[model samples]
Target: MYAYTALGGPEVETFLDLPIPEPGPGQVLIRVRAAGVNPVDWKKRTGYRPAGAPVPEVPAVFGGEAAGVVERVGEGVTDLAPGDEVFGQTVTGGYAEYALLPAALTARRPPVVSFEDAATLPIAAATAHDALVQLDLPPGSTLLIIGAGGGVGVAAAQIARRHDLTVIGTASPAKKDFVESLEVVPVEYGEGVADRVRAAAPQGIDAILDLVGGDELETLAALLADRTKLVSAADRATVARLGGAPVERARTRAVLEQVAAWVADGLLNPRVVEVFTLAEARQALRRVEDGHARGKVVITVPA
Candidate 1:
């Protein structure tokens, strides 16, 4: 199997022919049909490891979420069997022809949902759903999202709108039109972001979800009356200091099932603006790493 994986740190990531990984206990292997490209895929190569992620064994594949048909199941995994169409976080890196997924974290992909769309739900859509559930705001309340043009932010904005919350999102000027299309009040992130957010939400923000952390998150924090509602997915330590916590991700199959259902029912769209073949995975990674993608970018693997 061919895998686009990290051969070394920084600039050494490349594609290579590798052995197909076997599923361990409570895991399943799938013939990857589509893998969602995310910023973390590239960041991991730069030595920015997320907590609990296994240390990269040379040639570590470059993706986390994937959608495909099950090929094999490990011991203790029974709910899913061979031929099941499923999507979830990968245990064997998703940027390959085949990958392993923890069975408990995987969910069936609805027939109405395409592999490209299902691939985006495991991480982006699931995080958005988790963030909103953490905020727990009611209808008619105003919710402000920082960095709303990226994959998770875009999902959060649309899902918030659907739940009857007035949504305001911040993104680059280039994404203003696209952000507005999601029915979110678009605020350009820049020198005067605070002013723009204040102007957009005169009723005061009921809660805030921050995807772009750092000084920008600090700037937005000042505008909120209740700091407790502030949630950050980027800088956990910083958010903790600001009296806010990181987005408590559910990371469960049930969450994936819910988001997949939303996509299948047309209630939520991952808005996959770009699709690349596995051979073109570099271009796909570049698009997300360069912060140029307005929505989700996916890499498709052929049967």
Candidate 2:
């Protein structure tokens, strides 16, 4: 199997040949067809380990979600069998041609969903759904989505529209048009952003879903009268201090299936904006790391 792996920390990713890993009990081995590229992929490559997460062994593969046909099923896994077309959160890494997925988290891919589209749902789309569900905002209320040009932002904006909420989004100037197409009032993020949002929504924002962290999270927090409605997928501590909560993800197969259903019904768009081959994984990571991609980036592994 070929994968883009790191030796230790955030360094140059190199394509290497590695032995295929066998699935453990309750796991399944997938012949990866496509893998989604996310901010966490680059963050992990650049030495951003999640809190209390163990250090990955040397030459660790990069990626968290993928879609492909099942090559084999681990012991006690009866829901899926060999040759099942599946997609979901991966066990270790999804960048390789063959990756392991815990059977519990994986779901059967719908025949209508493309491999590239299904690949984008497990992490970004699922998180968006979870955040919206957490907010539980009523229809016709205003919901603000920070980092609205990225994958999660796009998904959240679309889903928020389905809920009949007025949507405002923050993004770099580059994504202005993309944000507008989602029917979200686009606000440029930077100095004086709070005033911009206020001007955009004179009635005021009812809730916030933040994907970017730092002082900006604090800035957005002030827009709402009830700070309890604030949620951040980045910077948990800062959000907590401001009376906001971190996005609580369901991370279940059911969540993935729901996201797919939304897509199939034309209510959600993953908006996969870029696709790269396994050998071009570094370039794929670069697009996401620089924060320029308008939507999701994916890597396609040849059969």
Candidate 3:
């Protein structure tokens, strides 16, 4: 099997003859049809890994989300089996011909959903749903999302609108028309952003989900009537100091299923704007790393 992997310390290259990893207990090996590319993949490759992420062996496979047909199931995984079409976060790397996904985190894909779209749900869409659930804002309340042009931000805006919560989002001028199409009041980040948000939402912001952190997180924190309502996905320490917490993730199989159902029902769009082949996985990673994708990027594996 062939896969794209991140070598030690900022090195990413393709491995054309990697051996397939077997499914372990609570895991399933899938013949990947599509994999989602995210900023985290590049971050991890460059040593900005998430807290407690295991230091895998050199040449570790790349990607975290994928959708495909199950080739085998591990112990205690009874809900899914060989030939079941599923999508979820990868326990093994997703940017490959075959990879492992935790059965508990994986969900059966509805026939109506495409593999490309399903591959994006585990991280971006799931985070959006979990953040909204954590906020627990009532319908009609105005919600604000920082860094709204990106994948997770876009999902959150659409989901919020569907739930009847008005959204005001911070975005780049390049994404102006796109963000507005979601019915979110788009405030361009930097230079009087707070004032722009204020102008967009005269009713005031009820809650905020911050995807861009650091000084921006601090800037957004002041606008909230209740500081505790702010959730930061990027800077946990900054959020804590402002009397808020990090975005709480459900990280459950149920969340994946809900996101998939939303896609099937036309309530959400994964907005996978760029599709790359497995051979072009490096370009996919580059697109996400460049931070200009403005939508989800995915790599497809041919059977």
Model 3 RMSD vs true structure: 1.8
**Residue-by-residue lDDT tens digits, candidate 3, 45-69:** 6656556667666566788899999
> Which rank order by lDDT, best down to worst?
1, 2, 3
Please, what are the lDDT tens digits per residue for candidate 1 over residues 1-303? 334355444367677888888899999999999999988788777766656767777667789999999999999998999999999999878889999999999999999999999999988999999999999998999999999999999899989998899999999989999999999999989899999988998878989999988999988898877888999988787788889999998999899999998898899989999999999888888899899999999999998
lDDT winner between candidates 2 and 3: 2
**Tens-place lDDT digits, model 2, residues 32-127:** 999999998767765677667776665777889999999998899999999999999987689889999999889989898999999999999999
Q: Which runs in model 2 stand beyond 4 Å of their true positions?
A: 1-10
Candidate 2 residue-wise lDDT at 281? 85
**Per-residue error at 126 for model 1, in Å?**
0.2
Q: How accurate is candidate 3 locally (lDDT)?
A: 0.87
Candidates arranged by TM-score, highest first: 2, 1, 3
Cα lDDT, model 2, residue 35: 96
TM-score to true structure, per model = 0.96, 0.96, 0.95
